[model samples]
Target: MVNKILCATRNGIGGEIVQVQANFVRALPAFVITGLANSSIQESKQRIQSALHHIGFHFPALKIAINLAPADLAKSGSHFDLPIALLIALHKKGIDTQEWFAFGELALDGTLTYNDNIYPLLLEIALRHQNAKVILPTSGQELFCHLPHLQIYYASSLQEALQILESPESTPAKTQTTLNFDTIHIGDTDYYYEREFPLDFIEVKGQEIAKRAALIAASGFHNILYEGSPGCGKSMIAKRLRYILPPMSLEEMIESVKLQALSAQKPSYTPLRPFRSPHQSASKSSILGSATQNEAKPGEIALAHQGILFFDELPHFGKEVLESLREPLENNELVVSRVHSKISYPTAFLFVGAQNPCPCGNLLSPSKECRCTPKDISSYKSRLSEPFLDRIDLFVQMQENEQDPKPSLDSATMQQMVFHAFSAQKQRGQSRLNGKLSEREVEEICILDDATQRILLQARERFNLSHRAIQKLKKLSRTIADLDNAKDIAKSHFLEALSYRYIS
Candidate 1:
């Protein structure tokens, strides 16, 4: 007798269907599984056999050959245990086995267990197999419920699964809900912190121009660099800027959840904008996701999707590591190429970098005397290539202040302003903020008056701005105008945008 059960195998983020075919022939007893099985799939034979004996079912002492169909594709993971066991059981009981899909891990006691990659499997199953009934473990049912147009069956044990299959008409139907699987099942919510900009413009006690630049960066999602001596509150203000940024939309939230899942990060629901601070000693693979023999994982930039990727002490990082960000910074996606496959992960993050003016950390300090020579300062600056610097939209010089004052706008106040600005941008019938605007969108939204155009042209000549720098300036200026509720790009906005450019 022969029986077949439908199952799935996941490769990367996608899933492929594997038909588990069991043949009980009248010959010498031997159990075999073919179809390019990996170590994990090969090991499932023992797990399934042990689970069957644990449930008081005898192993058929016949030539039992199990074959995963489509003999070319590789099958991995323990998710095939349940389906293989079910195929053997149906063959033993002489039951029909062609109407349903089954996937789950099995305990030694025959209890159904959850598999780690079930979410992607469920998504793929829902998308590919519409008419087939899906039988997954009870614990994974909540995640699978979000998927529509499928008859889902929840199984707690091998015996229970058999009972449901034997008496399908007697089993009760389950109601489907509209809940989002991404938002549920997060173990820890308290550890997830949103960006809170507690230090306001008034609290700085000085550097009003820097405060204005910060506001523009937050409003437009533009990249900003703060270069000054140590203890200038550049780091302080940058940390707080996250709190002042606008909230994420539902689509953004979904993207964030997917990225976190891909990276195996917990606390999937993140209401606040993500602020990723990678250390100077971080590796290239950590910054950009690496591809392995089995899967490709998301890197820091992808994890910071739709949020901020902050690199403090910018020049201290490896030149190669810093330059690696050029592609993702421009394309909003990271392409990891391996010998076999090239996978692209979305990484649409706002870049914010902070650094000292010199190695001594006092080149621009008002009260401290600079100990470093001009050569040292030049060497430090040259470490960051011009191409990398040009990608930065705003670069402001922070000056040390002696006084410490209360913050002008707390997180709550700044969040309100940011929300309002975001609302205004949306009112323009475009969901993208200023920083994310395409060149055509930039030309459409950021219309400069004749006087403002002349000012930008002069700045372009005076500052020796590259083509990329000019576009970045226009985008930043548009964000500033949006922040102030201004109808057009004014000269002041252009000046504010230009002031952020890093110059010795």
Candidate 2:
């Protein structure tokens, strides 16, 4: 007897359908699996046999052979355990089975264990088969409640799963009501409320110019570089910027949740934007992304999709790793090309970098004397290449004070202003925020006066700005103008935008 079951496999955040074919015949008693399975998958034979005995089910004494079809693509992970077990049961019992998708991990005691990478499987199945039944572990039941129009069977043990499979009529079908998997609303809870930003512009006591620059960076989703002495609040202000940014939309939230699900992180359907701060010692593969023998996994950038990717102590990162971000930063997606497969992962994120003026950290201090030579400072700055700096839009310098002042504006007030500005930009036919606008859209929306244009041209000549940098400046100026509710870019906006240019 031969039985086939449908299972799902994920390849670099994308999903593929796998067919598990099992055959039982009157031959020498043995178990075999084929179709380029990895070690973990090959080990499923022992797990299945042990789980069957623990569940008080008898294993078939006849020759048993299981093959995962589409034999060319390599299959990995222990997720195939449940499907393999079901096929074995069908072969042993002579039960007719062919219509469901099964995925789960089995414990030694036959209890079902939660498996990672269920979201991609669910999404792929939803796209292919509309009325397919998915048998998942009961432990992960909550994760699927948001998905609608699919039949879900929550099984706690192997015996329970066998029972559900054997008696099709007894299984209760999932509800047909449409459910939005995005936008988790929390009423009267801390999860719903944005966190209070401890560091505010007024509290800085100085550097009003830097404060204005921060506002523009936040409004436009522009990458910012803050260079100053050690005691300055460069890091402090960068951390607080998220509190004042506009909330995420339903589409952004769903995309983020999908990435989180792929990374095996908890998916929260909340409005809070993601913030990723990786250490400088992180590897290129970990930061960018790497391919396994079978599938590719998302790295830090993908995890921070639609949010902030802050690199504190920027110069401390490896030059190669930092340079790898040039493509993803420009294209909003990272393409990991392996010999066997080419996988692209979405990595649209806001880049925020901070660093000291020099190795001594006192090169730009007003009161403190500089100890590092000009050679030393140049060497330190060169660690961040011009190509990387060209991608950054806003650069500001922070100043430290002996006494921090009282708060000027709280997160709520700042959030309101950001929200209003965002609304105005959207109303102007610029659907996305300033940071994500294309060249044509930027030119369409960021119209400047003659005086502002002259100033930008002069600054472009003096700073030797690249075409990309000039466009970035225009976008930043547009964000500043939008925040002030101005119809066009004024002299003030142009000056502020120019000040952010890296001065050698």
Candidate 3:
């Protein structure tokens, strides 16, 4: 009988199950793996060869052929080693690996292990093939403990695996992951921070208006831009915004985990929202993803889904890269079209950008003299086109020593306002945050009185705001009203929303 066992391979955001088919023929002894396996998978031959031998498996001279089925798609990862080894060693034992899938990397000595990189692919299996039985490394059993329906068996070594496969009916299922949406926190409670924010709003020394703008941005999930001289607390405020933003749902936590797992960085699986601050030097391909004929890779924007993407020294970035932010900023999702396939990735994130008013970093400083010429400042400002600037929901101009001697707002305090606003929106049955309201939803939630509507029209004409600008303004007003616990968008809220629209 032909021995068959299934394993996983990443296919875009999802995965594919590859069947390891082993055929032992009576011929000259040789081991071969076919079907476009990568060098890592190819290198697994010696490891698996030694492992089966070390586990006391020695056979008469025969040709051992292993082919990863569905040969059209290329496969990688050493996790393929275990299933292939199992198929080769257990064909005579008549063990039915067809009942479940297996995944793990093998050492020459027969130990089994995997990494967080496999977590997402494993999750894809859980999502697509619900109630599927899977045998994964015991090392990551905790990763799946909370997931129900799917049964898992953890094996740490080749010997341990043999014992389990020998008595399949008696082996118990392993622990799975359980996602808790209710264990949410604003800053320091139930959730975890990858690193403690060393600076607080209380330590910022000044710029209370900028802090208020930050609070509104956090409460509404609004895109914000900051123009100030260097060291003007712009970066400091952006850093603290994630912790103070609305609490995440269980779905968001899982999405965050998947995004990080797909990237080069390791997944933290924390409830804390992501805060991705890519430097100005990052490439367009790095900010937006890149795709080949067979694969698509996520960029900084996709990686920042359900969280924050901060650009410091925004003007210094490439014009193409800066303009590329338009798609995600406008539609909240990116549609990447290539020759063979079109793929979509979530780009829902709060885009926070900070730049000096001028290249010399002193144009807006009251204490320091302006060294940049008018033309120089104009060119520097031109880096951010009008279209791009119009997309920003909140724009704050920070002045030197507009700074207070002491800080007043803290993250906990801001989080309280954000949480209150969040509760207000939810109480009103709003499905999305204020910043993400659709045009129809904006009309539904943003209730402006006659006077407030007149002021909005007047401000729209005065500022020459586009329809999108008006919609964003309404959302901002709605957010301000929510923070104030007011039902209607008051005149003060409308004017306050308009005040932050201009760079001045």
Candidate 4:
């Protein structure tokens, strides 16, 4: 009989579960591993043999054929090392199957080592099959101990793992809920990056209009654009906004960690929102998803899912990257298609873009003289298409000022406003925030009274709002109404939403 053990792999955005099966026949004592194993996995034979010898166990002296079954699935990473080795040891030594899903890399000294794949892979398994019995390396035990499902066991060495397999039903000594943030008090914990944004919203002087727009954006996760001169607090306001944005749920925290795992960066288990600011020279492939590479990679937007994506000097970004925003900005997700396969990733993020009115960056500055010709200014503004501009829910133009120390709101005050709106959204049984309302949800939920409809009709005819823009306007109105603590969209709410349209 073939000995089979279970494991998982990081396939795409998530992962796939794999079965490692080993069968031996009376032939030459050769160890062969098959089924699309990548280079790291293919070279595991020597490491496994060395690990067994170091741990006082001998390699199976028979023709051992190790096959990763249902073999068509593409598998990668060194996380498979532990499971493959386990199958060989169990079959060769006449040990009964323990039915454990093992994942970890083996060191030549017979101890388990860390791989970045463990977090994302185990998260996928626990979510799919709760109550799973898993054996992982001790290095990352703290990272996953808070999992409400899976009964996880940590083994520090190959010798210890074999002892666990041989003696089933014995609980491992080192099992604790160290990764305990799953039940963490959201929004109140002293965060990992406590000092990320040093400046408060009150420090942003003489831009109450801009702060008002920021308030609405934070309340509803709305996409916002700021047109301002240099030193006009455009980037400053954008940075502070992340601190005041609403708290993330447990599910949002999990989604954020999984996305970070796909990139070179290690996954952070904090409830703090993501803030990504790609440089102006970054390519469209880097901004949006990339398919030309060997594997499809989730771009910055997907990485910014359930958080904020800020683009500084927005006009300097390429047209392709700007145009690609239409999908994620509206639908809240992106389907990256390759010739071989297609993968969809959730990208529901608040987008914040900042730009100067003219190429000289002094078009709006009161004290600075403008040197750029009218054509230069026109061409720079023309780079942003009307369709792209319409997707934005709020727009504010700012100019450099000497000082206005009188504060409008600090982070604490603004956070209260956001929390109020968030409470209102949830009380109304809304699964999404106001700005993310679908066309169907907007119509069904944001029912305008006769007076509100009159304001909307008058504005629609005067502005010649397109169907898409009108739909977006309703979303904006919904957010404004939520901010006012109103149960319904009144005429004032509709008018305020209309005032934010394409400012001169």
Question: Could you say which candidate leads in TM-score?
Answer: 4
The 0-to-1 C-alpha lDDT of every candidate, in the order given, reads: 0.76, 0.77, 0.81, 0.81
| lDDT by residue (tens digit), candidate 3, 104-218 | 8888899998765577777777787888877778886655555545777789988777777787475557443434433434333233223344556777777888999999998
lDDT of 4: 0.81
Clashes of each: 5, 0, 10, 0
**Candidate 4, residues 285-370: lDDT per residue as tens digits?**
78887763235678899888878999999999999889989988889988788777777888889999999989999887788898
What would you estimate as the lDDT of candidate 2? 0.77
Model 2, clash count? 0
lDDT score for residue 80 of model 1: 88
Sort every candidate by lDDT, greatest first.
3, 4, 2, 1
- Candidate No. with top lDDT: 3
Q: Give residue 134's lDDT in candidate 2 (0 to 100).
A: 83
The TM-score obtained by model 3 is 0.91
The positional error of residue 224 in candidate 4, measured at the CA in angstroms, is 0.2
Q: Please give the lDDT score at residue 249 for candidate 3.
A: 57
Model 1 stretches astray by more than 4 angstroms:
1-6, 92-101, 124-133, 140-153, 160-212, 402-407
Q: Look at candidate 2 and give me any clashing residue pairs.
A: none
lDDT of 3: 0.81
For residue 466, model 1's alpha carbon misses the true position, in angstroms, by: 2.2
